[model samples]
Target: MFHIETEIRLVGPSMKTIKVSSRIECAMICSNDNCCSSSYDTILEHCSFFRDCCPSKEFSKESQTLTKISGFNPPPKDCSELPAESCSGVYVIQPENRPSMTVFCEMSIDNGGWTVRNDYLHFILRQRSYQVRFDLEDFTGNTSYAVYSTMYVGDESDNYKLKLTGYNETAGNGMSNFGGSSLSGMMFSTRNRDNDIDERSCAISRKGAWWYQSCAAANINGVYSQKYSNSAVYWRSWREKNGQKKTMMMTKPKP
Candidate 1:
């Protein structure tokens, strides 16, 4: 059976569009074809079919509606496998051996196809090779970023060991401090999970989860604070103070 949603529209490019008499007809056509998802415009009596295994959804103020037919193929592993016209938004993905999840894609950045990191970071990284990008913004409104050619994180059973290399110096290697002995090869540490070599839990001491050695030389997941401190978002190689206003870790399949 297929599920239908009213006043909800699929937000990506449609592979085909045709005039239909009703929503049922639209769904029937999509069900017969290999398309996994489709949408229908009630007022215009139009039907649109998408090739995306799982497309992004958005509430529509118009008469448009979307549908998801069951028994179709599984969703893509990452945003890079999506169509070139896919927009920046939340889409469903299923990494190898992992449950389906909704993740935001940064489509506006460098021709799009970037998957924002979430709790499934390890699962996504372990599924395949991906190039990682770090975006940082300071309280002064200045922004800087660093891109690595390769990044891999082991599964939980392996302590989520981090591996990074191939720094692109053109973007200013602010992550150099993190790619050193301080973080590379280190297991991830969190507030409740202690995996660092430090005598104490770095996550509890620093107020964030990260791959830490004795503590951290650079931590992008630190707490957001107005003042500089060991618990605030910071990249020591770029600035001594934790005056960061924003930070983002994004990944995409390496070209």
Candidate 2:
């Protein structure tokens, strides 16, 4: 039997941690199936997940930081000994009102069709978009790797370039608790037009924090290592292009 636990946390604009009562609720599933797939709904009230899910709130003039949740577990006391990656960066925003992020990669022919799975983590704030690039030398037979990527802009505006910043990679040994396989980034953010140039705005320069987990990577770890975060993951063994492989994050299919 497989059990999946979920947790959500919300931080105040002032960086204050807010506690909220929340639990995972099952919307639909199939049980005792007789072959035909049927629809059903169930509520799991005993879900012991407790955290601050900073529910949707109006943007206030007060400048504050969002709590960056790095992983399913809490961070270690001493980060100096861990091999962490920069989890945030200033990305060129493809202004839109959808996905808010995307992943990019090149097609591969060495392996069969491959699949890429991603998770949107809200460590600091939900990322406005997720754009990952993969090498497609094998699939496209190109002399160089081309970027196949997607873009999920937020609802803020159809014309605004977002600047993503903070980035933290987990420890290499697989003991990253407040860590998982998820990458994090900034959500939809724009200029505070209400404020004057002399006023303090964009108070926090740090990128919205969070993490990303590849569904493909987590599946491979089962056979290789014991420690979770540091162990080998699905990214190492994705098929070249026989199945569910992502070429890029474009508005439509590539030419």
Candidate 3:
């Protein structure tokens, strides 16, 4: 239903995978009409490409590492009170394969004309990680990628306080001060900078996971977490060369 957590695994410059950990069917109601808010007893498994988060970025057999996948620049939920200063503004991605979610349609200058390259993207916030993916694509020239963004949630490994202060959400580069707690840490982001769009409106969200503590307890809120799964791979793509349908990437976008 929703993604509680998403772990990104970049196997190659053009190939990466996303392993999501979330719940499945939502529990329904009782005789009283008010359904029990308890979570589903079982979890689900899903595997997809992080690049699949965007469609326009994928290339056909003629694929090349025009741009590499960033290690993953997690982002803080825009609504979160975390200030820009206190966030990990500078994404410290592996230089070779830095995360490049924000990409412009670089139509071949000589053969460039009427190319609307877009990677309709989305984010999944979980207790530990924020996963991203693209769902649309149509391109003429080759595509380029950019590190769209990264955000943070919480990690108890350091301290009970949810104050890591800026950019500490980017994993490995996350937090050193707080070592080894078990707080739910998540960073969600997207390539779509246009927040005006309906889809971009949900840069951060939940699945079906609940708080380990009580809703009234510290770091414990009675809100529904996102339910993630292996089937999270919902994407589409098409490519045109010389004004003819050259190829159709029948797969998800690769990071």
Candidate 4:
């Protein structure tokens, strides 16, 4: 599958250029090559292949950028479909009936196959059972993490409800404070899309989007700051005053 971006063209050294009868033919040629990006000139029926290219702001009525989706043939539903030996990097994936998208996979953590995506958490979590890991760093430079053996979220129709269990105490129960609270059933909330139970938009007040119940007991997506603040990244059960200096979330198919 190819993602076609209209009015934009891939800007880079062209490896080859040929006259094609249609955009489909151009995409087919690109698919066979090692190239991931290509450009098609609608008016002239010219197709240009590129080794490395991205959609540039140079808009043209006759140009369209085509990015070839790379991964397993059917496109892995998630990173777990990739070989265990696959290295950490960005790869393409397409969920059933969903659009193709690139995701960064962390292949060195806990035997690899961890998919990382903060924006589309529910979209991926809803597909299957996963083990969630949270890596956090406090302002004082102390680092800690927490892992949940079972985690998943509901669909948008369900307000992206969150569900988590199987906390690994050995890894530090950073979520102990609220992981089992109303947060488990709380719906995801954002600045513009308020599904949280709080009267105010927790996403707006906290400066980030998350599953909030009357705000939050822990918010890793919160604002990055050096001092304590309600909007700063924090895990109440871990460290509160000084919001975390760094935070990361990753998930993989549960073993």
Off by over 4 Å in 1: 1-74, 170-182
Per-residue lDDT tens digits of candidate 1, residues 132-238? 89887777867777888888888889888888888774335545334455356878888888988878888998888888888876677888875788888887767
> Higher TM-score: candidate 1 or 4?
1
User: Residue 238 CA error for candidate 1 (Å)?
Assistant: 1.7
Local error of candidate 4 at 212, Å?
0.8
Give the TM-score (vs. native) of candidate 4.
Answer: 0.66
lDDT tens digits, residues 100-194, model 3? 33222211221221112122112112222222211121123343211112323333332222222222221122111123332233232222321
Q: What is the C-alpha local distance difference test score of candidate 2?
A: 0.22
Superposed on all Cα atoms, the candidates' RMSDs to the truth, in angstroms, are 11.1, 22.1, 21.5, 12.3
Q: How does each model score on lDDT?
A: 0.70, 0.22, 0.21, 0.70
RMSD (CA, angstroms), candidate 1: 11.1
Clashes of each: 0, 64, 40, 0
Lowest lDDT sum, 10 consecutive residues, model 2, at: 23-32
> What ranges in model 4 sit over 4 Å off?
1-70, 170-182
Native-referenced Cα lDDT, model 3: 0.21
Candidate 4 lDDT score at position 72: 82
- Greater-TM-score candidate between 1 and 2: 1
